[model samples]
Target: MLLELKILFARQAEQQLLQTTRDFHSCKQEEGQLVSSYVLKMKGYIDNLERLGHPVTLGLVLGKIINELHAMLKLYEQTLPKNNAPALHVIRAVKVKKLNKHKKSQPQMAAMGQNHGKGKNREVYAPKPKIPPPPKREDPAKDSICHECGETEH
Candidate 1:
């Protein structure tokens, strides 16, 4: 009887572990959720998993956080105007794994035995400079011209 009871308890523990693992894997940040709250929720799942004898690495947690943040940023971009988009600096500081390639890589001509005058030889990524829009002309008469009707006053 004691052996049977022990086996039942072991089965129950295994089931609990499985459920916890499922919960951890299925956790996702909902739309419009704050980043801090999402991270806290994930941390809670991590804690639960750890308590259930499953170990999660710090790297895994951080990667998960970054992935969620990246997804949120993309969603935000679609809804927000181009001018309101998040700055590249913030994303770079977060060290997100992937970014849209804005600038093409070009090989620089360098002389032999010279490291381009820089201490280290490495590729640098920089955001493209923003150019202001051309100034608008203030000719009301010119603006009033209609090609189809040939009328200066609409």
Candidate 2:
């Protein structure tokens, strides 16, 4: 009975995965469809545009795309996911990840040097770093050293 349920779940998961891929493809197409329709309409306007040659047509088409993108951004801003906090959080997280890819990070560690900063080497499969070590003495036998002879007085 347990095996049957497991098989059933596996089948369902496979089906859902196939359906998810299908839906994702369809969603991409839907977004494209909106953009393409705008592009086609822009094409139509360009075709009939008079007293203007290739450059004007290209500019007009590009301007139309920009307008479409601006409008889409506005719509997205206004109708962002609100309820179903988990789904909204997931969506926002994905958006943040996507946005982060375009951003620059702080100064890289490689600039520090090979095995940089005295034993601060690259971690292979370790967890987070620990606390800083305590300060050490500059010269342990400073008191025993003679100032005149530059030797240990003891």
Q: Give the worst 10-residue stretch by lDDT in candidate 2.
A: 118-127
Model 2 ranges off by over 4 Å: 1-38, 50-60, 84-89, 107-154
lDDT of 1 by residue, 38-147 (tens): 88888988898788787799999888878878877777667766555556545553443242143443345354545464643343444578899999878877678798
Q: Against the true structure, what is each candidate's TM-score?
A: 0.53, 0.32
Ten-residue segment with the worst summed lDDT in candidate 1?
96-105
**How far does residue 145 in candidate 1 sit from its true spot (Å)?**
34
Model 1 root-mean-square deviation: 11.7
C-alpha lDDT of all candidate models, in order: 0.72, 0.55
Q: Root-mean-square deviation of each candidate, in angstroms?
A: 11.7, 24.0
Candidate 2, pairs of clashing residues: none
Best by TM-score: 1
